[model samples]
Target: MLLEAHSLSFSYGNTPALSDLTVSLPNGATGLLGPNGAGKTTFVRIIMGLLRIPKGKLRVHGREVATESKALKAVIGLVPEGEILVPDITAVQYTAYAGRISGLSSTEAMDRAHMVLHYVGLGGDRYRKIDGYSKGMRQRLKLAQALVHDPKLLILDEPTDGMDPKARDEMLDLLKELGNDHGKDLLLCTHLLDDVRRVCRRVLVLSQGRKMGLVDIEMQGKDTDLYAVTMRGPIPPFIDFLESHGFKVDVDTDGEGQIALSRGAADQFIQHAVSQSVQIRRLVPLRESLEEVFTRLVSKDT
Candidate 1:
């Protein structure tokens, strides 16, 4: 296990942030997804040891984070949500400084900084002032700084928040490479469904200060098969008939309906249409996207 949170709870003076959240994360890339004020930031703060664990257990790398925060931080790297760079400093200088802050010696820090800069594709611009760097370049710089110490675990919060489509794709590609080929465990926190779908295998969802669910990104919203059916006459009768026959059905006002069923329900659907004296104009399979899955889950929880 890479992370385990059992009954984790936190709050401000009056409002609750996280409420009885428990999850176990394996070694790989996972996404933390939620809306605003869903306690995603609170969870990250607890993992980074910036906030004290007030209620329950949190373990990273099999070590309890509340008692062994220093050890946990030593093995964890974080790229925070917003810009934390010094305007006057260069990328190489900032990255080396970050390495030293992580307990590397001066020489080792410089060496690793150079190597990670190249690895992040910032080798040529490493010496330029961070104040003038583009947003994408700055995001890469943050990633380079986070990787300079070569920690075992990396946590990124809203890494591609402000990026354009092209830059976002580029950043996601780099993250895929890091998580898949570099043997690093990653936790990406974002609300972007596509980002999570593209980079993570698992997703932990939070809503209204509670754990909505944890789901496999690749396998979610796939079990129930959906078909768009258009009929010549009375769709309500057909829908009610299908429901009575154990198939879930919904319809629009235009005599078009969506039928959801298990593997062997299609034969029953055809039988129902024929017996009900309805004409089936067209039937097409509708693939559910990840966005729909996220929306459905969040709406259900909320």
Candidate 2:
């Protein structure tokens, strides 16, 4: 398991932040999803060892969080939502500083800083002061600093926040490469569902400081029985036939000559369509979008 929390709970004075949360997250890329005040930041802070474990057991990579936080921090990197840069320093200097904080020797830190800055596409501008960089460049620089230590897992908070569309796509592509090709585990915390859909295989949703759902993004809306079908020629009779036979059919509302049906009745549906001289143009299984899944989970929690 990448992370395991058993009966985890936390509070800020009289108010609760996390409420008896229990979850096991596997290795690989996973999205952390939640609405405002949902404890997402609190959870990340706890994992980063900034907050003490107030109650229950929490472990990262099989080590107890309460006892092994220092050791765990050595293997975890963070790309926080807020800026961590010093305006007077160059990107290389800041990145090297981060590496040193992660326990690397000065020589190793400087070398790794140069390598990671290049890897994140900041090599050309690495010597320039951070105050002159654009939002996108700053975001990438944060990523460079996080990668300076080569941590096994990266906890990214709104990594693409404030980026334009092109920059957002580039950042997402980098995340995909790191997770798929570079063998890095990631915890991508963000408000954008599309980001999670694009880069993460799994999602853990929270609501009101509680675990709402854990979803397999690829399998969330797949129903073997449900299929989208398009047909040419007259559609009313085919629709009538399927509806009369007790197979629920939903005609496409956009005038696309498409309908949805249960796959169990597909043979009968197709046979009737053939008998009626209707052409089956397309038939494919339907998958739910991450937005739909997120809405459903949050709604249920409320």
Candidate 3:
């Protein structure tokens, strides 16, 4: 019951950015997931009071957004998609300045700066110039500034966008820790399905500025994937045996190949192959990727 939006709708000229969007987010991380131009940014802007939604109701912590925007901002921390740090400034200096702007004293700001930076996994480089920092380090700096004020809610837009795989994983892990260990409410806006699966428990999906889907991430992730599996055991016959039963299989002599189909098909194929005296060290479902799911959802919505 931390944040709620009822019948939230907005448009620019003849095109709509959000259509009758409605959702209630709890205390944990709630993922606002969709592809580009899906109105995810518009949704965050409305909640952050950056853009006014002429229609519908938006509230934070039982306070009306229109009437208490200042109070609302005091309790909300935003990490935008782009870089927010001063390139020439060190992480400590920028974070301390942000803390002071959030209404902390000089001493308190410095303390909070170190604290948030440490929590964000930049303890050693808290004084490093942001211009020379890695993508991961810069991401951590953005998050550190958002936490300096101790806002009740944190809204992040593509926090790990420019990172390599390892950096992306690190940023995600830090975000998870922020929500769980720090007792903060999170509004995570991203197109990465792995982010949703790894961090947020609840999810809202947007498409073409219309509220297309709202469901728990758990439900979306529950066995709807098929993996390309490999095995080191007696897996040589798995592919041929599966094809003979109309399972549509592709093989690899090294016992590594793909079996693409429905979730039911994957499970049945694995079970049947195992029963046929073929030992499979791995029975992976070529799980549908997040981008693929988003594409399918948008296509179907239209």
Top candidate when judged by lDDT against the true structure: 2
* lDDT head-to-head 2 vs 3, winner: 2
How good is model 1 by TM-score?
A: 0.82
lDDT (0 to 1) per candidate: 0.87, 0.89, 0.80
- State the lDDT of candidate 2 residue by residue for 66-120, as single tens digits: 8889999989999999988877999999999999999999999999999999999
**Where does candidate 1 clash, by residue pair?**
none
The candidate 1 region of ten consecutive residues with least summed lDDT is 215-224
lDDT of 3 at 254: 76
User: What lDDT score is found at residue 302 in candidate 3?
Assistant: 77
RMSD of candidate 1 to the truth, in angstroms, is 3.8
- Once fitted onto the true fold, the runs of candidate 2 whose alpha carbons sit more than 4 angstroms away are 231-246, 251-279
- Kindly indicate the candidate among 1 and 3 with the higher TM-score: 1
Model 2 poorest ten-residue lDDT run: 252-261
- Where in model 1 is the C-alpha error above 4 Å? 225-260, 263-287
Candidate 2 lands at a TM-score of: 0.87
lDDT of 1 by residue, 220-300 (tens): 655658888888666777677777777877877566878776777777777778888877888777766767767777899
TM-score of each: 0.82, 0.87, 0.74
Question: In model 2, which residue pairs have backbone atoms overlapping below 3 Å?
Answer: none
Models, CA RMSD each? 3.8, 2.8, 5.9
